[model samples]
Target: MIVISSGSNHANAQTSMNTWAGATAQRVAYSTSRLQNRPDSAVTRDVRSALWRTPNLDASGIRVRARLGTVTLTGWVPERRQISLAGHAARSVRGVRSVSNQLLSRNSR
Candidate 1:
């Protein structure tokens, strides 16, 4: 009886997986590449989100600007290393064509 129940469950799972796959096949995949066609404001938001997600990077004071695919980051980070990290993060966003990192370390500023 238990074996029969497990087999039934497996069949249901497979059916659900197929349904989900079929439903999602035509759905858009949200990733960095999708941001390429987005506007500058959208690019700015994506860059800001990227900086906030970067490890060991303090983004509390960071300000992001985007213009014609050019990104400018201004503000202060807790550490000098975070400046480079912020730049890299900004550049990784798909819509960013260039980065002007103006981040100053807290101690340096």
Candidate 2:
């Protein structure tokens, strides 16, 4: 009777493992479909590029990262206003959901 109980427990464990694996696979597929449906990623890239090329704003030292419709501006700029400008520029983008201005001011040379 003990041996039979052990076998049942093993079977239950295997079943649980299989369920977990199926759940994981479903999650992966869902994530992939969601990502494929995301339309803002391309817009974010375009916005970053436009910001980088905007006149009067020095984008050389700035770094831009975007995820899930949010754009994060990092690195350094020469003036405080540049940080705001970067944020504004990012916001002007068509698909930008939000902008996080993390730009640091650099001392003048």
Candidate 3:
């Protein structure tokens, strides 16, 4: 018996592996593999590119680094909202296992 859990009691119900739901689950697993195996260099470039693309956030002073798929954002922003925006931008990039937002608001200066 094969069971796929989707956060409900019925998730324990057995289903044929040939079902459409099974196919969807397989696709999700494949995508997860891609996320786990991304190179740190690629992840860093993607995060930096995303930061540059995000509007309303002046990422000029921001520095992005990636290690083992975990991205760290550091430096300063003009406002508190920009800090959150910068973190969001980093998190949105593919292959980012996690984000450590260390950006400081100008108020702290």
Candidate 4:
């Protein structure tokens, strides 16, 4: 005859449950991080498009980086207004949480 103890069965079940819970938590975390980056990518694209549409702002020299919906603009512009213009254009994007304008003026030196 085969005999199975209840306590042993309970402990085995608990271990399986814990393992499954850990795996599920990891998957959720990975999915959340992946989804979060999508918006930031879209924000970068939208900011670049906005700059291209604006006049007198040369977007070719501008660099746009986005993380967690915040955008950092780095590059050179000919005038001070162009800096403000770049910031404004970045802010206009829907997914942009904030803007860090670091544009340098060519004549500031």
Superposing all C-alpha atoms, what RMSD in Å does each candidate have to the true structure? Answer: 10.3, 10.1, 10.5, 7.3
Ranking by lDDT: 1, 4, 3, 2
Per residue, candidate 3 scores C-alpha lDDT tens digits across 25-56 of 99999998865657889989989889889999
Better of 3 and 4 by TM-score: 3
Report lDDT (Cα) of residue 89, candidate 4. Answer: 94
Cα misplacement distance, residue 16 of candidate 1 (Å): 41
Q: Which residues of candidate 1, in runs, are more than 4 Å off?
A: 1-37
**Higher-scoring candidate on lDDT, 3 or 4:** 4
Per-model CA lDDT versus the true structure: 0.85, 0.78, 0.84, 0.85
Superposed on all Cα atoms, model 3 deviates from the true structure by an RMSD in Å of 10.5
- lDDT digits (tens) for residues 35-73 of candidate 4: 554477788888999999988887777999999888999
lDDT of 2 by residue, 42-102 (tens): 8667767878877778888887777877888889888777878888888887667788888
**Any runs in candidate 4 off by more than 4 Å, and if so which?**
1-38
Q: Taking the tens digit of each residue's C-alpha lDDT, what string does model 1 give over 27-106?
A: 64545456546698899999989988999898999999999899999989988999999999999998788999998999
Positional deviation of residue 2's Cα in model 2 after best superposition, in angstroms = 66
TM-score per candidate, chains pooled: 0.64, 0.59, 0.66, 0.62
Q: Top model by lDDT, which number?
A: 1
